[model samples]
Target: MIRIATPDDVPVIHTLIRELAEYEKALEEARATPEQLHEALFGENPAAYAHIAQDDATGEPVGFSVWFLNFSTWRGVHGIYLEDLYVRPSARGGGHGRALLTELARICVDRGYQRLEWSVLNWNRPAIGFYESLGARPQDEWTVYRLTDEALESLGKRG
Candidate 1:
């Protein structure tokens, strides 16, 4: 079962995020606190939205997706930028991942969005394979870039 996330789901969402970071071998960078997440998701002006996938029988959350909108100039429409989608290690392969993605796709289609996108670490073969199986193509022509920390501060000062 899938449903929109409520404020009560923040703790579990944070846990899933930490678990995902661990899986990606970057746990140290997963520094978001539950309060920060709550404010992000439930603040007066929400920056993102989330969905929870519940265990069918027990109704316990087993997976989740957090996403925000991104505008596409070429497509002339807004698309969902999935920040994270994760199923608990013990609960993987139970269709939770696919179910979460299907829901997002449906939202895109219903809202007339042109695309649904997310980035994957290069070494995550299992996730890449799973996404490919759902007909998701890689945008290999474009390389992702980031400016953060001291570099970001320097640029801010230069400007």
Candidate 2:
């Protein structure tokens, strides 16, 4: 069963975030705190939303997806930018990941959004195959860039 996440699920969500980070070999870099999650998801203003997938019989959450809306200037419409989608290591092949993505697609269709997109690590072959099987194509022509920490702060100071 897939359902929207609530504030009460912050702790579990944080755990999942850590688990995902560990799997991606970035556990030491995972800095999401429960307080930050609570404020981001349930405070006066929300920056993102999440959906949780639970085992129907055990009622235990098996996976989750965090996402937010982003604008595509060329498309001139908003699209769903999935930030993280993770299934517990023990829960692979249970369809939780697919179900979470399917529901997100449904939301896009229902809301008339132009697209649903996310990034995967270049080394994750299994994930790349999974996404390809789902008819997702990589944007080879486009390069992704980011500025963080000192660079991000310095840029802000420049303005």
Tens digits of per-residue lDDT for model 1, 1-159: 889999999999999999999989999999999999999999999999999999998999999999999999999999999999999877889999999999999999999998999999999999999999999999999999999889999999994
TM-score of 2: 0.96
User: Each prediction's Cα RMSD?
Assistant: 0.8, 0.9
Model 1 local distance difference test score: 0.96
| lDDT by residue for model 2 (1-159), tens | 999999999999999999999999999889989999998888899999999999988999989999999988988888999999999978878999899999999998998889899999999998899889899999888888999889999999995
Q: How accurate is candidate 2 locally (lDDT)?
A: 0.93
TM-score to native of every candidate shown: 0.98, 0.96
Q: What is the C-alpha lDDT of each candidate?
A: 0.96, 0.93
